[model samples]
Target: MKYGYYPGCSLERNASAYHESAMEVAAALNLEFAEVEDWNCCGATEYMAIDMLPAFALISRNLALAAEQMGNGRQQQLVAPCSACFLNLSKTDRYLRDSPELADKVNQALAAGGLHYKPGSLRVRHLLDILVTDVGFNAVAEKVTKPLYNLRLAPYYGCLVVRPVRKTPFDNPEYPTSLDTLMRTLGAKVVDYPLKAQCCGGHMTQIKEHTALEIIRRLLKNAADYQADAIVTLCPMCQLNLDAYQDNVNKHFGTNYNIPILYFTQLVGLAFGISPKKLGFGKEFVDAAPALKKIGAEPPPKAKKPRPSKTALPMPAPAEED
Candidate 1:
């Protein structure tokens, strides 16, 4: 199976591990992902809020590229690993398909860039969707090199992928089952987290620290109640919010929730016997070393700390002298 991959900006930067694991997993699954050429942004949360038409056009422009670059004009698939990107791409296609007025407006914007997107030309899916629905949970189970047996995982859906159901194309609105299925395939017990779809307060963490911490507290609290060893998620944003801010959340809430929030790809890479380095463990703030330790995968080599730049001479322009 061939898919068009959109790594999004974050994956190239903060989520490099996601990109690495995705490649390893794609190889393991025997599915080829040909990245589309020169793809633009998906117009994430910010664009839609600022202006709807151009935002949809930007996302649709990507969809149009995915459609045009399909290996054989077969089923067009865009493997979006980020929930926000997936939601925006999927939402725009769905909305445009149903709303002619909106479609016309978006297409008009596309005209400026000499790009045109036909509604329903392609399908936008989260990485988990492709893993579970396209690849099948059983196939994933068969690839387990080391089962995460007895590891309790809280499958967090975050708000973007499953919420505002009208936009997402995956499973049930209120309850998504992909992550749970993927977890079970890895031989771990999946906990039914009530706060799975609850907002992690996303980028709002910086804008509204207290509220974001509270929201994060709830998710960790529920995961703790279920005694989850780790929180598995599909979005880099959710993982960043929960993992990077875990210390702050615990500090504020007076609770020590030590659960590691891991991208599902990291888990899959582990299960497939890929080295932890390839899975990008060192990049995480809270340190998944101990967590990966529990599963018998050795920790990645400690990344070298950067050396400070040497003192520089003061700027001086030779103007002169005599």
Candidate 2:
């Protein structure tokens, strides 16, 4: 089936691996994705809290663009790989449909660009939702050329993905099992993680790091408690907060937690027999080699190259390729 893919900002840079592996997995599954052209950010999780009208308007632009981009005969659904983008776009669409006055105001703003989106014109969906429901676990399991045997994993949904249930309405917000089931389909042993749908500190790591680390520590501690080899994530924000700050979390709590944080799509790509490098394997701060080795599928470490001169280029945060 074909879909309107909205990769969002993070996927292009920090989560480039997520974008790479997702494209690889979608190709393997025979799913076609036509990216939304000239798409902008969804205003993230912060903008809405700052200003409702502007935030909704910003998000509505993407929906308007996607609605216009769906060329005749293609489905009117736009799938987002980023949780923040999915939530923002879906929330704005739902609200615009629910409120006529707000829709009028947003449409007025879009008028300058010669675009107007009718609420409900496009369906906003998460990549995971499409995979589990449309693709089906059985169909995905059939693609297991290299099942992730002997690997123990904790499926971390974080928040936002399944939350605001009345709006999203697919999985249980409190305790989602879609990822758990997906991991099982890949032949990886799924751990009984209580914090499966828990918050991953999100931007709290930036605002109040101590609080964020505490929240992050709880999730990591639980995975460690269950002896999970790695924690699989659905959101890039969750992966960034947990993976990038893992060392800081360890230092702050005086605890040693090195569980590799991986994108669920990466594992799915691995199960499809895609090389780890192609799946963005070694991009994580906490090395995934140890965990991948358990399944006898660890990719060789990439060779380090000389750093670019400071005057020549600025490095990307959350680690860039060597």
Candidate 3:
């Protein structure tokens, strides 16, 4: 299916691997993505909090451009690969549709640039949502030439894309499982990760170093606890925080955590038999070689749980039972 693609800012730089892997996987899946012409930054997560009108206008400009490009096409969906971009675009559209006063002001601002947008004119969707929902797990499974067997992955949803729940959200906001199911379809084992939907400290890393390190440490520690080969995520910000700051977190916490943070698309490309270099595997700060090497290898045997001692005291009974 054809859709308008928004690579956002991170995809052009630090998260280039996400863009590369997405394109490779899209090609393998026979999906056509026409990039929005002259798309600008969606203001990410900060601009909206600073100034509402300009932020919405900036985000709406892309929507207007995408709508104009589609021009009567049945599919007017605009896909943003970055979590920040997706949330900004989706939030602006929702706000514009809900508040006519804000919409008028945003349109007035847009008019200065000879552009106008009507909130719901185009549908804003995240890359992961579209992949799992529109593409279908069965279709994705069919393309897996080399299954990611024996590889254990913790699917990290971060906290943005699924929050401030939409009228028709693709996945559960509190506890999303779409990514988990997608990983399993590629033959990878999905670990039980409770913090999958937790925040990854976004720009806080730049503002408050200590706080950011603590948050990053929690995610890394949780993934390590689950014995995951890697933490797979759809958000560029989450990957940046976890992968880029792992060493800093280690230093601050005095803990050694070598968990690799990989994009969901990278794993998809790998399962489709794409080469690691082509999928931009080495671009991440944490070395993914160790985790990638375990893809087809046999899983380690499970350790037996220790039996309770016969001399141990009996457990206390509940007050009601007593």
Candidate 4:
């Protein structure tokens, strides 16, 4: 199956391993991905709230690129790895293409850039959608070389993946279980954490540290309470907020709840039988090595303990021989 990919900015830096594991897993599943040429940012959470048109236009710009650049203006559906980008890109494309007033306003802005987005020209899909609907869980199950039989995971939807009433079509806005289903396909024990779709407080980590930390703390505490080995996610912001800021959250709350926040792609990599080393398990700020080991996934076998330096004991032995 071929998918036109729009990786967004996070994939290039903070989430490079996501791209790596995604591509490798896609290859394993025979998924053909063609990335949009010279794509731009999706305007994330902040841009949309402040300036609606330009924000949508920014996301639309990438969608327009996806339609225009992918063979003589032929519309092509884009597969987005980040849930925020997926929702933003999909929402803007859908709303603009549907509402004439909005489209005219956006097109007026587009006049300067020589870009116009035609409605229904693009289909924005999240990585999870592609994994289940396109690739099929059974196919994913077939590729499992090492099933994660014992590990329990808390599926964190964050805020962006499912909400705002009407955008994505996968599952319930308040509670999403597709990720849990995918994890279960890999033989993981998925938990029913009611806070799955709760906000991780996003960039509020910068502007409102206390709020972000509180939110992050709750998610981690709940996951740990549910006996989760880690948290599985579909957004870079979610992964970054949860993974990178975990220590800070602990400091703020004066609690030590350590749980690895893993990307859905990394789990897919494990299901596709990729080694844990290539999956970037050790690079995570939160130590995932322990949880990974529970899945029988180790970091290159810890390099066999070096043999005792021969010279130390050899000196006395050689003297005796002499």
Candidate 5:
């Protein structure tokens, strides 16, 4: 019931709602999350490409910290709510165990801080993996105060969660059903999403705008084509690309899609009878009020002035100066 929580960069900023809702859900399920002390960034998706040894060393630092926290001898069950964090940590752990040379190099870097990580000493996992495997859907369904009746949701797992099949043996690489099953457990009708495991073009939007839009376009178009009310996601990167750049996708394709990309944990929080305000509901660029109305979930309190049109949402800009 206890886990070492790793709320990566996104959870502290852009995907704060996911972190909020995840903590809310964990509390309701009687799960305890002790955040890893002095955890660092997992180098995200871009850092690895920039430099390999540094990226592995950076990611290893977090794993080393998590293992150190499990002072009582058992392998630490470190869970991350962000997909990028999960992939980086999980991949780092795997690579470290698989390659002794790499493991030695990472350990040497850690020795500078008087820390040395033993590969395979920490059980790195995603929040979704814990919920489905450890918490169980039946237990989740039992706690639902308000089932998501009649809500047709597309469960978008995106690429990172299940890709590189060897990493996530439990999930099908081509089409995973864990998210879809989780939504159904909340009483929402799960749409058959063909692009469920497709890439969200992580960092591609910043690198090649048009190319990223096309990749995002396919996912959005597929969801709309299936008549899904909204897209529920497990990854912050996926959620950001789909939700924040939605307008750009529309502009590129000349399509008017207002699909709300929501964190899967947010819906779980709703079913557990948590308030929208606590779940960070109104923070999304795309308003989810229209879709939530279908399930009778309370909308965010309205502002006196009208909300801006989707086009008026701040465009994706270059990284701002600190």
Candidate 6:
């Protein structure tokens, strides 16, 4: 199937692995993605909170371009691999369709750039939704040359994608199982992770270090408790938070967790027999090789580290009120 692609800013830089692996997996599945021309940022997770009109305008610009690019095509779907991008795009389209006043203002802003987007002209879908729903698990299973046998994965949805309860959500928002089902289709063991839809404290790691670390620590602890070999996520922000600041979380919480945070597409590529190097495997902060080795082999028993008693450690000092 052919669809318009929006890689978002994160995919071009910190989350390049997601883009690379997604491309390889797309090739394996005979999917065609034509990138939208001159696409801009999606205002990320906080831009809308800072300023509503500008944020919607910024997001709507991409929508306008996508609609123009896929004019009258059988498939007018624009796929975004980043969770924030998907939400921003989808939310903007939904809001514009519901609020004519807001759409008029956004279009007035777009008029300056010679672009106007009619709401609902194009369908915005997260990459995972398209992969699982459109491509179908059976088609994906047939393409897996190296099934991820024996690999235990905690599918982390990270509070986005299947959220805000859209009119036709592809998965359950409160407790999603699409990612879990996808991993199982690849022959991997899916852990029953309750915190799968919890927030990863997006951008909060920089705003509130202590609070963010605690959030990150809880997720790591839960996944570790389930004996998951790795935490596979669908969002770039979640992967960045849990993988980049993991050391800080460990130091602050007095925990010795060593769980690897990976993108779901990476495992999908691996299952399709793609080389790790080509899949952007080494870009992650945590080394995925150790967890990946568990596939098709009897991994040596993990060494248990003595965790410090929570009661013994002093609670983090409260943040001073402004």
lDDT: which candidate is best? 6
Best by TM-score: 3
Error of 5 at 314 (Å): 57
List lDDT for all candidates, in order: 0.81, 0.89, 0.89, 0.81, 0.87, 0.90
Off by over 4 Å in 5: 164-168, 296-322
Structure candidate 2, residue pairs in collision: none
C-alpha TM-scores of all predictions = 0.86, 0.90, 0.91, 0.87, 0.90, 0.91
Which is the winner by TM-score between candidate 4 and candidate 5? 5
- Candidate 5 is scored at a TM of 0.90
| Deviating ranges (above 4 Å) for candidate 1 | 71-75, 164-168, 296-322
lDDT of 3 at 195: 96
Judge candidate 4 against the unseen true structure and give its global Cα lDDT, from 0 to 1: 0.81
The TM-score that candidate 2 achieves is 0.90
Candidate 6 global lDDT: 0.90
In candidate 1, which residue pairs get closer than 3 Å at backbone N, Cα or C atoms, i.e. clash? none
53-163: candidate 6 lDDT, tens digit per residue: 999999999999999988854438999999989988998999999999999999999999999999888888999998899999999999988888888899899887888
Q: How far is candidate 3 from the true structure (C-alpha RMSD, Å)?
A: 5.0
- How well does candidate 1 match the true structure in TM-score terms? 0.86
lDDT accuracy of residue 292 in candidate 1: 62
Residue-level lDDT tens digits of model 3 in 1-322: 8888999989999899999999999999888999999999999878878987788889889988898888844538989989889888888888888999999999999999999887788889999988899999999999988888889899999998888646777888889999999998998989989899999999999899998999999999999998999999998999999998999998898999999999999999999989999999999899999988887744445556556588878876433200
How many clashes in each candidate?
Answer: 0, 0, 0, 0, 0, 0
Q: Write the per-residue lDDT of candidate 5 for residues 225-297, one digit (tens) a residue.
A: 9899999998889999999999998888899999999999999999888999898899889999999989955
lDDT per residue as tens, model 4, 1-322: 6678999899898987788888888888888899999898888888978987789788878877788866545456689998788888878877876699998888787767998778678777888878888888898888988888777789888776666533547777877778888888888878878799898887899998888888888899999888899999888888999999999988887888789989888987986778877776666788887887787453223234446686665443222100
